[model samples]
Target: MPRAVVRQRDARHPALPRRAPTPPWTRWAAPVLLAVTVVVQVATPRTLDLSFLLAAVPPLAALAYGPAATALLGGTVLLLLELPHYDLGHPGESDTATVAFVAALSVLFAAVRSRRDAQLVSVRTVAEAAQFAVLPPLPEHVGPVRCAGLYRAAQRGTLVGGDLFDVRRGPRGVRALVGDVQGHGLAAVGTVAALIGAFREAALDQRDLVGVAARLDRRLVIDAEDAGIAETEMAESAGDTGAAGTAGTAGAAGGAGHGEPAELFATAVLLEFAADADELRVVSCGHPPPLLLRGGTVTELAVSPGAPLGLGLAGVAPPEQTAVGLRPGDWILTVTDGVTEARDASGAFYPLTARLAALTEVRQRDPAALADAIWKDLVRFSGGVRDDVALLVFAWER
Candidate 1:
């Protein structure tokens, strides 16, 4: 078993309670502060100037025990410091005012902490719902193609990332697309929705796969430019890197021009399979090549060698369609980088081809069964992914 999987299993055991690590500064702050306090009392002895010491207490305590504990500790320290004054009957009015100040500070801290927790919970909930809507449930079969798909997000609470996959049975044939956008979260999901919507519409109207890709590319480019403007405004305010690395890559893949503004592009593999003719046509645009598994052997389908869809770059050419003959008992597997690039704790990539080779021995050849097995193997290999993943498999039974 991979180390990450082992650790995850160990974490789940009821006997073990996960403990948060102690922050280095938090662990030593109180002792250091107390030492300073004592030193001031002994060395200078002018009643010990403790105003600075009192001001530092809340922040230090908050770091150690969280907001509530910090507030409690701050109040306790104040009471202790004021005790000497109270007993001496010196400045009784000032002591009372100090206590009231501590009370107000504590209440403020607690309220802030509560609000932060609520916001985090709300964000997580919304992310989960969005993920389900974008991904949905994979169909057992689409047209004559038996289909299976798998997806994962690199970050926790992010169900849908830049990666996207969709299979549709339409009037033309069985069509599927696996693509990765420039980034993750809502922005990526928005691009995916636009691309999928365009593809669905174009696939029905356009007889050629190239035409479909072109149509989708146009829509994506427009959306990306518009989104980029919004992103730029926000980045200026936040001082964030505005679509630097990922955006550059997306644009390069799409074949954007040198003079063109940075835009979101995608690496995508499009597939159209005609059940009547047992023919498979594929167009790959800067995307990982799909694997065709047959008789326990896996073969990588050739990418049509086309530029990614969005680059307005000059001299960039569109991708061509590559055809493959499909036979009974043959299976076609399509996946995004999230599958092939999945790294375990040891930094070893999952052996997708080898795993699929092993699956040929299984007696069941149904599309769902094949897909499920592949999905399970991928999860086992990655010990759970740190990125979003999508997998699709189609099998023609003998």
Candidate 2:
């Protein structure tokens, strides 16, 4: 495989953006402010009255330093305020006492914030690990093309969701997928994993995207059948073991409507960049057509849709595969319906093509920048998305 995978983080992903570091001088901000206060206090008329300013040093220190350092700085401030010569005015006892109290409070605040920050970091670390493990990052470069992907779960506080996309190098070529499982949240994670696994396995030896799609359909159908069998057996076992009164309740409950499992299905777009072929072979399984970005214009690829996976449609007949010619600077952008179907506050659907066209030609080439631009525009348009969004962007490396 002639591709190199790049993750969200600078090829860096998963890790949320952290606060930028403060300048080195900021480390000594509290001490420097204290020194300045002293200089102003002594160099000027003794009546300039800067005692309030002196009290601010320790609290400022707490913003940057830990509890112990904040406490030490607070102590220095208290000493300066109380020391006879340092006290330009015959300072009141209350002024010195207040400064000491504030310093102690700053130390306490520092300790609490420090503890919370550590906890947040640990939790975020675990979440990112799980997300990366379940759905590894897409390839940064597929052959001479640069690839980038982004996924945002509709389920609050979760990194992974029902939507999925992946790009992997294989014997057939570099096959990429953008798919959406039926529902959102962790409940759909198992199906997402199974489909991804099937895609990856098929990509290793399958000659084309059609075969990959067929395999995915089979995997979902098989899983759904197994789940149905388990539920049926459990219902029967409960009916046999329970008292007659309880059995009737269970039978009535099952009869009322819970017996039938919803059909499992997923819409997907699969792409195969065959070896030495300067084009993309695309197969759409009830998925929206991918948009082509070339020469600063966006055009939806004209690919015929077939039945979604899990309906066993592929077994009867393979989905139509369209081969798109690739230009040296052409970019292919595909996404789950979570993006295309997203509606704004007025109930207007998101204008994906219009938004893509709005981006400056230069910004459209960088996958990360493109993702950010679209995402910001999306948020601005919809207030916020309410569904899992999976996006993929890859351009012939320029």
Candidate 3:
């Protein structure tokens, strides 16, 4: 998943990461180096004989320029070597030939570097496309409310993680879902995608937040069962194979017993904004209590806890929405355990409530700034986050 991403305000695009451009310092260094070499060779005494410095120009050019440009720089250095080796004085024959050989090698090195760079760019493009398809960038706005989202994976080099959040505007109102699947990493991605798919569909078709939660619950249960059947078929098809024996041993390791149903549950919170009133309907399903920031005070809403989705809880005790009144400037904050449970060297959990109350800047800032400040502070407090962190902020911006 992405190490840390903070997105807000007016970016409707897919957030496609563009090709990294050459650094400005590197681009200008080649020519500046050539000019400085000539000037120093002239300004210094004849005994100094700065022919050796010319060799550096080719390799420096290779850092920012293509093979053709690198060769051109190398050729210029060779011309200087031929013209008495330096404007100041003549260097020894061995030194002159050494500089020439180094320049030639630099040109070839530039060609190899450029080719590998192109290959890297191509691979990056495909990887990003696949990751973003699983969890695309969040929108800037959802009807009257402005939106801000932050996601960070515990593992490096991943654009999407197990934690997922999305805001959608539908016939009911602006609805949002913040969820964290049972586990982290690529292993939980399929579950994340399935949940998001169900949430998006339910957010539009379902008349209320409860219905949306029900939809997600059913999705999790169905997907889990299908996965079990597939696994069974695979295990049976490979009967007596070494791979099957290894799999059975691994599954039975530590007396965990073949995949418990609890592994399928996900803690989530569903919210729906009232189009006509200054209120929000929230249903917490084993998710952390959301924070309500009003003026200068931060209040963690006392939401009734319900069983997590995917454990067949809809029949026993379905999650119900709790109405919370909102003011013009109030901000709602929600996050995964990655943030609240982040620990310090002493193994203390992050004091999110205390920090939110103390950080005066959070109140005056917009939704984007508020989310960024929280994330930055979280990182600073934990020294380094070791789990997937997902945060979402919402404010009535009308």
Candidate 1 least-lDDT 10 residues: 1-10
Candidate 1 lDDT over 262-318, as tens digits, reads: 567888888888756888889888888888877757898876677886774233677
Which residues of candidate 1, in runs, are more than 4 Å off? Answer: 1-130, 185-187, 231-260, 313-315, 344-346, 363-365
C-alpha lDDT (0 to 100) for residue 158 of candidate 3: 69
lDDT of 3 by residue, 312-336 (tens): 8757788767999888877889999
Question: Candidate 1 at residue 156, lDDT?
Answer: 51
What lDDT would candidate 3 get against the real structure?
0.79
Clashes of each: 22, 7, 3
- Runs in model 2 deviating more than 4 A are 1-6, 10-124, 237-242, 248-262
By TM-score: ranked, best first: 3, 2, 1
For every candidate in turn, the CA RMSD to the true structure comes to 10.5, 6.5, 4.9
- Per residue, candidate 2 scores C-alpha lDDT tens digits across 119-222 of 77677666667776778866668776688777788876566789988888878577888999999988899899899889889988788788889899999998
* Residue pairs clashing, model 3: 1-158, 1-159, 2-158
Q: Rate the local accuracy (lDDT) of all candidates.
A: 0.66, 0.79, 0.79
The 10-residue segment of model 2 with minimum total lDDT is 1-10
